[model samples]
Target: MNGATTSGELRAHNRVRLLRAVHDGGATSTRSHLTRELRLARGTASVLVAGLAEDELLHEEPAQEHGRGRPTQVPGPHPRGPLALAADVREDAWELAACELGGRVTVLDVRPHDGTAEGALVPLGETIAAHTSRLGHRVIGVGVALAGPVRFGGLADIAHLGWRSVDVPALLGLPLRPAHGAGGGGATLGNDTAFAALAEARRGRLRDVRVGLHLHVDFDLGGVLVVDGRPLGGASGTGAEFGHMPLEGGDRPCMCGATGCWGMDVGANALLRHAGLEYGGGRGREQAERVLATSEQAVAACAAALGRGVAALVNAHDPEVVTLSGHGPELAERAGETLLRACEPRLMAIRRDHPPRIEGSALGWRGALLGAMESVFDVFLTPEGLGRWRDNHPDQGRDTPGRRNVTHSTPKGDQPP
Candidate 1:
C-alpha cells in the first residue's frame, strides 16, 4: 500500500499523538481534559481510550467528583497485564524491580554482582526469570540501568565495574516466552544516570520546571540537561557526561582514562577516599553518612566540585534550576550552603541577574525506575508506541525490550565509597 493510502499509518500517528498528550500531562485526568488538551473531538478521544484499554494499556475509572454530568471515567493505571523487569547494575550489587504499566514498581530481587565483569550477567538473567515467573505473563519488557556511561548502541563504560565497551543487550540475555501461563517478551536498555535524570525531569521533582540540569553525584559524576522537559541525548548518547570534564587542580586518573577529571574530585569515591575508607563500589550510603557526620570537609569538597560543574552547566545552557539526584541531594542537605557559595565564585559576576537554582532531586533514587517504566509503556502499554513497534518489527514486536531499569546495592561492612 502506498504511504498516502494507508489506514495503518493514520491509526499509528493518531495513537502516538494521544499517548504523547497523556505523557506531557503527568497523571491521566478527565476525558474532557484530554480532548481539550489534544484538540481531539469527544468521539475521537473515546475511540482512542477504548483502543488503549483494549491493549491493557489504560484503565478508565469513575472520576472522583460529585454531580458529574454524564458518567466520566479518568484514565487510571494500566490494567493488570504483563510486568517489566527493570535492572540496575553497579560495581558491588545489582537490583531488579518489577514494574507494571503506568509506572507502579515492586522491587523483586537484590544481590551482589561483579562491579565490572560478564559474570554479573548470570544473576541478572536469573532475577528476571524469577520475577517474571512470580508475576506471570504480565511481564511485558525489560529495562536496564548501569552505573556508568552507556555509549551509543547501549554499550556501558562502567569504571568501577571494570567494564569498558560492554554491550548490555547481548549480556542481559533475551526475554523468554512464557513457559505455561506466563506472558510478556519486550526489552530495552539505558544508562542509569540518563534514565534517572529523565525520570526526575519529567515525572519527578523537576517536572514543572522547564529548563533544568540533573546531576547524579555518586561513585561517579553524571548528569543530563533538560530543556522543555526532555533530557538532551547528545550524539553518541554522551551529551551530559559531566564527570569526564577536566579540572585545574585535579590530579588522578579517572576510569574513563583521563587525568584530573571532575568526577574523581566530587563523586562518592572521592568522598570516601578523602575520609580514608575503602573506596570500593558498595560503600555509597556509608560514605554519604560519613560526609554528613564529619566536619563538612568532604562535603565541602563535593559541593565545591559540584558547584564548579553546575556553574559550567549554567554558563553554557543558562538553565533555570540545577536538580541534584542520587547522593547529590544527600550531599546538598549537608553542604548545600557551601555548594551555592562555591557557585557564586564560579559564576560570572557580569551575569548576576539570573543564576540557576541549586536544588535537590525530587524523585530521590527511584527516578530511574519510573523513567524506565515510561519506555516500557511507550513500547507496549501505549497505543502509539505499540503500533510503531508492530509496524516496524512485527515478528519481534511483543518480544522486545523497551527501557532499562536501574537499582544498585552497596556493599556491607564498609565505611562508605
Candidate 2:
C-alpha cells in the first residue's frame, strides 16, 4: 500500500508518515526529533513540514523546550485541518465529538434517546450534519462505535438493544461510496469493545504492548485482540466473542441466543442476576453500581467468574497483558484479589507464577470514541485518502490557519471522559 513509485506518490507517502508521527507523538514531538525518528534528512523534514503548513494541514511554532542546537519546530493542528467525527452509540445514549490529529477530542453533543433506531440516530444525524456543514470539507470521515458486534461491511447486531442486521451507515446518512479503490470518505463502524481495545493499545494500559486482550464489560461484554500495535480483525471482522464462549458453563440463555455464555457471570447483568434484579442496560448501569456497592457476595462471584474466564482466554491467546474498560474497573477493584485467586491456578502451570496482568483501562469510557476517531484517520490519512481530500478541498492552498470562530478539540491523552 506504500509503494512510492513516482515523486508525487513519494511525497504523499512521506506526508502521511509525518502526520502520523506528529499524531502519535502528540505535544512531545518536534521537527528536529521527527527527522531522527523517521530517518528523514533534515531538509526533507523541513520541506514536508513546510508543505503541510502551506496546505493548511499543520503549522509549526518555536518549541519552548529545545532539543539540542537550534530552536525546534513543534507541529500543531491547523485551524482548517481535517477532522474526524467520532460517535459512541450506546444502549441508551449517544455521544458525538469532533477530533483532530494528536488524539484530541471535544464533545459536541451528548444526549439520551428512546430505545428506537429512529429516535437514537435521527438526532445524531442532525448533529453530524450541523458540524459537517459548518466545517465544510475539513470533515474527512465519521466513525461509529456501537455497543454490538459490527460485521466487516458495517452490518451491526446490537443484541442488548434488540436490534439486528442494522444497516448503520444508511441510518446515519453516510454518503454512498463509489466503486472499490475509489479512495476513503465514509463512516467506519466497529464493535465498541474492539474499538476500545485499539484505543487502549494506542494510548492506554496496552500502550507499547505487543499482544494484549481488551474487554469492555457493561451490561454484557465484548472484546478485541490487539497484536503488534494493531487491532486484529478476525474472519468476517467479528472475532473475540469470549463472552459467548461458555466459559461460565451456565445455561442462562444469553441475549445473544446462546446458552452457557461466560458473560452470564461477569458483567453488570451477572451482578444483577446474583442480586435478584432484572437485567437492563443504560440506566441499568446505575443499578449495577448499586449491586456492586451493596452486594459483596455478588462482587466476589462476578470477580471470580471474570478471573476464571480471563484465565481461559490467556491460555488461548497468550497476550502480554489484559485491559478491561467500562464497569470492569470497579469490578476489578472490588474483587481483583478474588479474581486473581481464582485465575492463577487455572493458567498453564509453566507460567502460573507470572501470569499476564489484568488491569483497568486508562482511557476509561472514552476509549471507544477515541478508537473510532483513529479508525477514520487510519484510512483517511493515507496517500489515496489524502488525494481524495485534496480533490474535495481544492481551496486548501488559499486557506490560512486561524483560531477565531473555531472551537478546537481539546488534547486529552488517556483521560477519563
lDDT of every model, 2 decimals: 0.66, 0.80
Worst 10 residues of 1 by lDDT: 408-417
lDDT of 1 by residue, 1-417 (tens): 324357666666666666555544543567778788877878888898877666555556666776737777666445343455677776667777765444556666668765555678776876676666665546667777677766656676777656888766676666422111123354566667777877786676677788888888767788788877777767776666777778535777766788888888776787887787777554565665665578478878887778877787678777778888777887778888887787777777654577777777777877766666655655664443465433433232132222332223323221110
Q: How accurate is candidate 1 locally (lDDT)?
A: 0.66
Give candidate 1's error at residue 13 in angstroms: 3.0
Q: State residue 75's C-alpha deviation in candidate 2, in Å.
A: 0.6
The parts of candidate 1 lying over 4 Å away from their true place are 1-8, 23-27, 66-68, 133-137, 175-186, 208-210, 281-284, 381-385, 388-417
The top-ranked prediction according to TM-score is 2
lDDT of 2 at 380: 75
TM-scores of all candidate predictions against the true structure: 0.81, 0.92
Tens-place lDDT digits, model 2, residues 158-220: 766777887777778885332123447678888888889888888898989999999898877
